[model samples]
Target: MMGRTRMIGGLTAIMMILAMCAGCGIGGDGAHDAVQKLMDAVVAGDVSGVKNLYTLSVEPKMPTILTGAKLKQPIQNVTVGESEKVSDSERTVPVSYSLNGKKTAGSFKVKQDADKNWVIQNPPVFGQVSFDPDLTIGGKPSTKDNKFALPIGVYEVNMVSDVLEGSWTVPVKASSGFDYQGITANKNRKKIKLTDKIKTYNGSMSSLIDSFNLLPMCRKLKELYLNGDDFAFISGKSISSACKYQTTDIQIKVTDYTPDGDRDGYYPIKFDATVKMIAPVFTDSGENDDVWTCQSVQGGRQCAKFVEQSFELKDWDGLVSQSNGNVYYRLADPDQNVGELADVIYAGHGVD
Candidate 1:
């Protein structure tokens, strides 16, 4: 969990570059002033101040949730870099909010409004969302003449199984990614038997099924709609996963709980290590407050140091995902070890 290497150097570099550009690029008093205001707004999560500096008309794009975080280490050596103008309307800035000695630094974006107020808009998540391999790369020109800011990863997917055995299995994670690792007690990969008990999925259920994963459902859904063969047995590639969507649920499961949440859906925010990350919005089970947050003592900074946050740009009532897979967290019920084992074993078979 600590040391994860990204083979995509160009992609990683681009992420760094974009993050730098995000911090706001300008070295001097002006840059410091911008950074100071932005940091204060960010630390306090003052929507108004952030909006004013970033020049946002409507509510600015804050993180999805501003809950608490567990400082696995001390958060110290806080550093703020100048903001640089990346585009006519945007600027990137570097910030390192550290604790103890461990650090997590990233660049953030500050965009200018028509009236010229620098507003922090783009969250790092936008970059996290760009995994499309068809994405253009390098200085090379793609068919659309659009150059991707980074190199795309080859989204390869496969399925392997004793076809003699009839069963729906999930792909297992191997060194080279997903691999078909036979069947186990965890998941009952039936051995060549046409049984009525089959776990079948269609395009309509999960809102998040892109054109890629839907290949498995082709038998029932008809031809493919998206591009690419992120799946195993499937052939041909499509353009995008716009064909699939995500699933919807009302159960609120919190991990990193925080109080500074948008008017959006539920989020997990933990206070200290106890309090059991709660989301008052969905469960209405935890304590309620206008603004919830995490608190921990470290390096004398009390708690309240902003760690992570989320805000829903859409999802008025909680229809968060048009498809499925946009789950809050991958958790298991304490009462069901067998269920977990089967699920884990099921992940071995090829998705398609």
Candidate 2:
């Protein structure tokens, strides 16, 4: 009776081991099938499924990485190659895939998580891409005129599709230096158009100061339409409505300029500004008055203590115009003082 019981106990233990192996997706044949599932998810652009194949740490970046990959190439087919176990909890997988009619081979390391499910242990793959005419982002130029590696996965590239003038398999990150990363223009590379509306951008201190008309060097503001239009230059009076601010006795002096050490094309500008202004307007003075009132009058002191801002301007001479030896520029956004002063002036608070 004792011998027979031992034999049965050994058989039960073997069965339990097999079940654990199957559950963790580590069985002899299961690893191949798991890798095949991941390849299918990628080819099908199954974002959810592909995400499930990787651990949680890599989940957040997967979307951007996938978007860049989709723009770089199209995966037509994927074949599972050699796969071997490195340990009880880890395995290596080799795969060959067809992209844009080209064959490429890649390797992956997959590991079993605490949940006993297999997950991809390698960072997603990305493809290299560049612009044809070359462009700059946030005043920082792309590598080697216009080349950089795209992030991995599925995504769209339409911000400047019209401007690029060619259809590509993958989307490209919009040139930097704008308020938004994906903000783009459909105009020619050299003849890009500035929006009629004043807006903030990222770039160099010189570009910001010039663009905002912070100093007197900018005079007789003009718009240079690079589209070969005969107008060439438009006066400040003509585009006054499009400008951010009009100043009277306004002075902007740069106190300091600091460049970012780690990243290119970024500079922080510190400035001290004084704007002459009439006192704020007030509708009522006391208790029942709805508007907040400090004092209502004309001709008062408005001094900015210390203000710091960052800028990203790539095209200075090209974006602005220099004629009669005076440089002219339009404001990208409303100056804080100018905007406040405008309100005061609008409310009948003018210099006495």
**How far off is residue 28 in model 1, in Å?**
6.7
Residues 55-100, candidate 1: write the lDDT tens digits. Answer: 3233332222212311122224546787666766766777776433
Residue 19 Cα positional deviation in candidate 1, in Å, after optimal superposition: 27
RMSD of each: 32.0, 18.7
Q: What does the lDDT come to for candidate 1?
A: 0.30
lDDT of 2 at 100: 52
User: How many clashes does each candidate structure show, in the order listed?
Assistant: 78, 21
Candidate 1 error regions (>4 Å): 1-32, 44-76, 99-101, 124-352
TM-score of each: 0.23, 0.36
By TM-score, how accurate is candidate 1?
A: 0.23
